[model samples]
Target: MIVKKRRRPLPLTVLSTTFVLLWVLMAAFPFIWTVWGSFKVEQDFFSRDSWWFAIEGPRTIAQTGSAFTGDGYYGAWVLRDFFSSVVNTIIVTVSVVVISLTFGTLGGYALARSGYRYTFWLLMLALVFRAMPHITLVSGYLLPFFEMNIWGHLPTAIIVLVAINQPFTLWMLHSFFLSIPKDLDESAMVDGCSRFQAFRMVVIPVMWPGVITTGLFSFLLAYNDFAVTAMLLSQPNQTMVPKIASFLGTIQQEGNVMFAVAAVVSATAPLFVLVMFFQRQIVSGLTAGAVKG
Candidate 1:
């Protein structure tokens, strides 16, 4: 059967569509402009005379003998060694996600299945920690890190990021675990499986979506994190965000902020691809968490 909906008033429909289109253009214009400008020299992209210089690119043509140039990408990737920061980011984010999920899954499952009064208090404590500013938490670690001589390293950044992100993971996975019924675990246990075995075999497979969701969020936390990474890691060990930031500061002095622009575009591209690849899993995971069986 076909379903029909009431039509909106002409003025309201036009207004809504116009608003949406305007919002999309507003959101996309900066990135579209950045992508176009990344190929141009500073003078053309940041044209003082007319914006048409960006389109015509006379300077770019004069310098590179063509309208566009790969100088910025070459400068950042090859000359500046941006690939090291990319490697560091991958290591930190992957470590954070794996460690967070290892603990979060077990802790969340136990908390969700427990019948103790302390569970509520424990969750509230985690929530309070999660609600606190990340800088404050990072500040607390600085003194000890400096004393231990483990400050300014990739592992330190990963450890701090996990500490900051763990509470949120526990909370989210705890809710996801709650949405799962006890019968699955109980049935598995009755079939001669132990609790850990049931969790590994029966419960976890059904909770896979939730795990992916939590892991993705954990990945994003460590991936985009600036405070912990910047403050803890040394100059040689910076991640993508801080490295891009360093480009903004240093490239400005070199009179070619396009390096920073190029780096920004490079860093953002992977995140776009990652989200698209996980889109279905993310939606399903969110839906599973929201609805109870």
Candidate 2:
């Protein structure tokens, strides 16, 4: 009986695994260190004696008789009213997702269905706008927003975010719509349903995977935006990202760096939860649009 030899793993596979491991470590270490330090007092965390002071939190042990404490969280959340920023961020993210998805679905379906000569040009124009730096667009809005006296309001920021985010939204949803067969809607139409009814009854249900993925991108844009929110929103109306930036300025003076650290951890928790729950949809949506029937 002749036995076949087992093949060894390729060098490229080993290298790729190593690279991925290193990248994950690099990305995860900062957040892990920040969370570890958040439980420490300022002195222990920033001490020159040893970086291990942060890990051990000796000062926290001496004061609270525990190596960890909730002071940082309490200070940032209760005293600093970080909840308000959280609320603002949630509102902006939800509003942007809803508005962007609504408009993007209708506009993208139209572009995908239409045989007009201008459709290609329209898509290219959207691509150009999407590629342009958002800051440039923010500048033009400043004057108009100031004139209308709507600068620094949540509604104004929501509207601007919707506008800035639309180009990418249209492009992504348009591609997803292209992957779907036009015959699907036509079949529904042949069954005595109107165009809108066909779309509502047949297409929308199948379109959700793409929509969820697109909405995730929209949420990230609105949630992670600091430049637009900082420039356009008033102090009270600021979102979590800008609020985090503001913490850096006063943390040193206040001698409460851990508060900022805690706030950073708090802010990151939601995104982690979001990914954990919807990662499957995100993957499916991305891959589904790449192939066409």
The model with the greatest TM-score is 1
Per-residue alpha-carbon lDDT of model 2 for 1-293, expressed as tens digits? 88998776799779988999999999999988887888888888888788889888888899788998999899989988899999999999999999999988989898988999899999889889888887888898899989989999999999889988998888888888887999999999999899889878899899987888999888988988877998899999999989988988886565468788889999998888988999997776566546531
Question: Which regions in candidate 1 have their CA more than 4 angstroms from the true location?
Answer: 1-3, 280-293
The local lDDT score (0 to 100) that residue 284 gets in candidate 2 is: 66
Which TM-score value belongs to model 1?
0.93
The Cα RMSD of model 1 versus the native structure comes to 2.2
For residues 120-201, what per-residue lDDT tens digits would candidate 1 score against the true structure? 9998999899899988888888999999999998887887788888788888899899889999999999999999999999
Can you tell me which runs of candidate 2 are displaced by over 4 Å? 1-6, 9-17, 284-293
Lowest summed lDDT across 10 adjacent residues in model 2 is found at 284-293
lDDT of 2 at 168: 82
